[model samples]
Target: MVIILESLLGSMFEALLDYSEGFILRQEVGGVG
Candidate 1:
């Protein structure tokens, strides 16, 4: 159970990071390139 929760948390964190990275990248490029 703990392992499953940890895995899910990791995935959620990764998705959040990807979203943040995309947002920054868009800002730097002046568009969502």
Candidate 2:
């Protein structure tokens, strides 16, 4: 119930963070190149 929801939210947040970091890195590389 609550535990499951918390785990799901945590994983989603982590994934979003990773995606954002990757996106930023790509944007910087594209801007430089």
Candidate 3:
């Protein structure tokens, strides 16, 4: 159970990072073009 929870949290954090990175990239592209 503990391992499962840890893995879930890790994935969530990774997803959040991916989302934020994409958002920043979009903003940069919009600003440039």
The model with the greatest TM-score is: 2
After TM-score superposition, the amount by which residue 2's alpha carbon in candidate 2 deviates from its true location, in angstroms, is: 0.2
Go through the candidates in order and give the clash count of each.
0, 0, 0
lDDT of model 3, residue 24: 96
- How displaced is residue 6 in candidate 2, in Å? 0.3
Expressed as tens digits, the lDDT of each residue in 1-33 for candidate 1 is 999999999999999999999999999999956
Among residues 3 or more apart in sequence or in different chains, the pairs in candidate 3 whose N, CA or C atoms overlap within 3 Å are none
Mark the 10 consecutive residues where model 1 has the least summed lDDT: 24-33
TM-score of 1: 0.80
- C-alpha local distance difference test of each model: 0.96, 0.93, 0.93
In angstroms, the error of model 3 at 5 is 0.4
| Residue 32, model 3: Cα distance from true site in angstroms | 9.0
Worst 10 residues of 2 by lDDT: 24-33
lDDT of 3 by residue, 1-33 (tens): 999999999999999999999889989899563
Clashes of 2: 0
Model 3, residue 10: distance off in Å is: 0.3
Candidate 1: list runs displaced more than 4 Å.
none
